[model samples]
Target chain A: MGGFLAGVVGACAEAWQEVRIHKGRVLLSLIGVAVAVCALSGAVAMSAIAQQATIEQADSAGGRAATLTMSMQPSDSTATGRQQATQAWFDVLDRYEISYASRVFWGSSRVQFPDSVQEAGMTVVDQPYGEMHRTRMVEGSWFQPGDSARLAPVVVINTPFWESLGSPDLATHPTVTIDGLGGAKAVIIGVYGTSSWDTWPSMFMLTGHFESLLDPVQAAGSMPQYEMWVPPDLARELQTRIQAELSGAVGAQGFVSVDRSDWGAQMDDPTTILRVITMVIGGIILLLGALSLVNIALVTVRQRIREIGIRRSFGATSGRVFFAVMMESVVATVVAGIVGVILAVLLVQSPMVSELVSFGGISDVPPFPASAAVFGLVVATVVGALAGLIPAIIAVRVKVIDAIRY
Target chain B: MSLIELTAVTRTVLIPDADPLTILDGVSLRVEPGERVSIVGRSGSGKSTLLNLLGMLDLPTTGELSFEGESVPAMKPGRRDRVRGSNVGFIFQQFNLLDGRTALENVTMPLLYARGPRFWGRERIAADILDRVGLGHRLSALPGSLSGGEQQRVAIARALVRQPKLILADEPTGALDVETGQSVMTLLDEIVREENAALVTITHDPAIAARSDRHFRLDRGVLTVAEGAARNAGRADEPVTDGPVADDAVAVL
Candidate 1:
């Protein structure tokens, strides 16, 4: 056992010596490998960041994963029946102790801007809506708990709407008058950020405040979009239960519709498809690198035929020769892998690249993915082994007399 | 026990679409411990084929061959290789020192396979042997920088570093000038005597073979005892055996 271990150590030392002696030749062989590893690791790292961005984009538009949304129409054909079904859902929320749930209602506010009265798009939601939808405030806070009782309705306006209001300071309690709020001035408490495509002004206000001041005619046209977040494993069961409960309670028999409305509900997720594409491309690059490595290793073994013959004459067995030759490739590639990963980390972790790949803003820029580093190293080692096999076998088959005579 | 023995070894090489080429035909010889033997032949006279068989580098096509009284032909290839590594060393006409390696590294090469004490103490042993060869100060010198004679001396140190029982010298001085060749041969002869090891010299120069206890000439694939050279020294008490001898195989040393 000791001798076997020594043989391994000896082969490694011998391989290293050969590498050092022929450093220029080895360097020529490893350029492709370094580039390949860099591309692979860098792609994976970027893919991780991009995947998070995609999920956040989806979450911001719909809710987080496993969100169940429901809607209902009554056999009586009145809005009151649907409202009652929504109330039943709220009751279910309280009964089940589901922490993250939101009622989404879309309406318009008649804002009395200094220039003119502009009708701005507004989403009326409960306090938990900000957390569920990954909402970010640009200027001030989201609707805090107890914000619904401020007497003066609080609203979070987007940049366009905030600019329309002359960008008022919230510390001074700037107010905006609305046409249908029964003459009560609405407090502009926060500014909700919008994406580049959001050319029109938009706002978010507490559901309680919106309902208290809402005109009956405007409320008749809007319906509450009820959504609840549950653990993914329980989503299917809960979806069925909510559908049956709402369908039975509304007396619509089967008129109620309860299903997952968030981007997570989509069967064909774009992020997953993108990830597969990235891995395929990474694998191809790695294979090309292996080809170059195999070519160089073959040439190296051929060049060292005489040296190998000399080693055999001195007592090195066939196993020793094979191990040594193969180890040269493994060591070279491992070093190259390390260098490539470091380069990728340096490039990817830079703030510029991170923000750029995330489309300028992501809720959470994930840390450099550990899987990318591991993948790079593991792939490099595998490639080295594959590349070394052909050369090692060729080297082992060399006849001692022919090689010495060579 | 004899250090090595060969009985009627025939080595034939098959060629594509042609008659078989016989490299060595019915060759038989023996070398006892601490004895010196030599064989001389012209070019293409199968001197190297005999050396290859004796050094355990190649298996005979058909023969009964033994080393240190064990049947060598029947040993597993790996076992044969190990036995050769531990018990036999070779010096070549071209020195065959690894290029780009220092004199010390070249000498330490064999000890890498020595495993225990030798492997662990390789550098020191290599340095000591190089010193013994009077090239200790040049241990760090690469072959390209060393004179031809210094390189051959390094080769000698490498062969003797493992202290193998059988030393196979295949035209060890063929590439050297007369004086350098004579000096290298003297150094080799003295080292073998000091170590009490057997030496086998195969050469094309008869003068080089004249110093052996037993001398054989290989011509047209046949080996013959050169006149006035056989049984001249060492192992005189034992008659040249004609057939197989019992072996108390010790596995491997």
Candidate 2:
């Protein structure tokens, strides 16, 4: 055991010396390896960033993982039929002990923006919806507990809508009049960036306030829908139970169909696809890098044939010769891998890249993943081992009597 | 037991679609520890082939060969390699020192595979050997920058650093001038004696062969006793009495 360890240490030291002596050759070959590793690691890191951005984009659209969105279409368009559906939603929420339930009502209204009224789209949601969608307020804040007590309904408007409202400051409690069923007046509670919205002049308000603005004729068609944030593990169970109960309440098996698809699953589609594509690309780049290393290693072994012969004559075993040659490549590539990983971290995790990827939508860009870095280094070492194997065997086959040759 | 023994050793090379070429036939020799022996041959005389057989670099086609009473031909190739590495050291005609390594590193090569204290104290052992070879000041010098004599001295130091039981020198001083060759041989002789190791030198120079304790000559793949130690004190001033052969008779084996 001791002799084996000594042989290994000696081979490593000899390899390091060879690397030092042949710096020009080592540098030329290592440049290829470094660039290849950089490309692979960079692709991996960029994919991770893209995956994060995709998840965030998906979160803003339908919701994050474990978010079960239930949509019901009633065959009977009667007022009692829709009311029964809404009552079924409430009963399900109550029975399941849901703490983050929100009734969402999508509609449009004419807003009086101090000078003129402009038609705009509005989303009515409860407080949990703000937390669920990870909405950030640029001015004032999302709905507070006291907001429910105010006689006047409060609303959140995006920057474009705020600008359409003459950009009034929320500290003064600006009021925008909505020309709906009763022409209700609403106080502007907060302003948000328009990142999450696909359309300009978008607004958000409480579901109760939105329902109150509706008359009997409009209320028959546009009922407030419910979205509840549930734990990821229990989402499927809750979805099945909710579907079963709603079907039972409506007294028809296929009368009401619940859209229980989690948007998080949809988000994973792009991530998984990107991951596969990136791995294929990185693998090709790494193979090219290995080829380059193997070419240089073969040349190096050929050049050192006489030296190997001399060493063999002076008590070097074939194993020692093999190890010395092979370790030279391994050590060189491992160093190059570390360099490439550091460069990748700097390039991918930089604020400029994060800003470019986020594009004013995703605020929290994750740190450069350690798994990608580890993968790069591990692959580099494996590539070195594989690339150096053939050449090392050739080196070991050099005849000891070749020392007699010039 | 003798340090080396070979009986009825026959070596032949079979070229494809050609008759088998016999290099050595029915050759036998024995070498004891601490003895100095020399084999003189004209060029193409199969001296290196015989050296390879003695050095365990090549197996005999037919022979009863043993090193320290162990059957060498019967050992596995890996075991034979280990035995060769541990028990024999070689000196080449061209002073085949690795180009990039310093004298100390070149001398330390043998100890790298050794176990125990030799592996740990390799540098010290190499340095001490270099100092003994009068190359202590040249330890850091690469072989390219050294003089021929200094390079040969470094090779000698490398060979003896492991303290092997046998030393095989194939035209050890063939590339050097007469003065440098004599000095190298003198140093090799002193060291082999000091280490109590056996020495086998294969040379084409009659003057060199005359200085060994026992001398043999090889001609047409046949070996025959030449002379006893006619000049044991190794007077380098002696003139060659034998006429030179026209052809360079030492065929590379």
- Please write out the lDDT profile of model 2 over residues B90-138, one tens digit for every residue: 8988888888889998888888867789989999999999999999998
Please give, as one word, the docking class of candidate 2.
Answer: medium
Top TM-score model: 1
Worst 10 residues of 2 chain A by lDDT: A253-262
Candidate 1 docking band = medium
**Candidate 2, clashing residue pairs?**
B43-B249, B43-B250, B44-B249, B44-B250, B44-B251
Candidate 2's C-alpha runs over 4 A off are A72-88, A111-118, A136-141, A151-153, A159-199, A212-220, A247-255, A264-268, A358-364, A403-406, B228-253
Best candidate (score: lDDT): 1
Q: Which ten residues in a row have the lowest lDDT in candidate 1 chain A?
A: A73-82
What's the TM for model 2? 0.88
Q: Please provide, for model 1 over A21-45, each residue's C-alpha lDDT reduced to its tens digit, 9 standing for 90 to 100.
A: 8888778767778888988999999
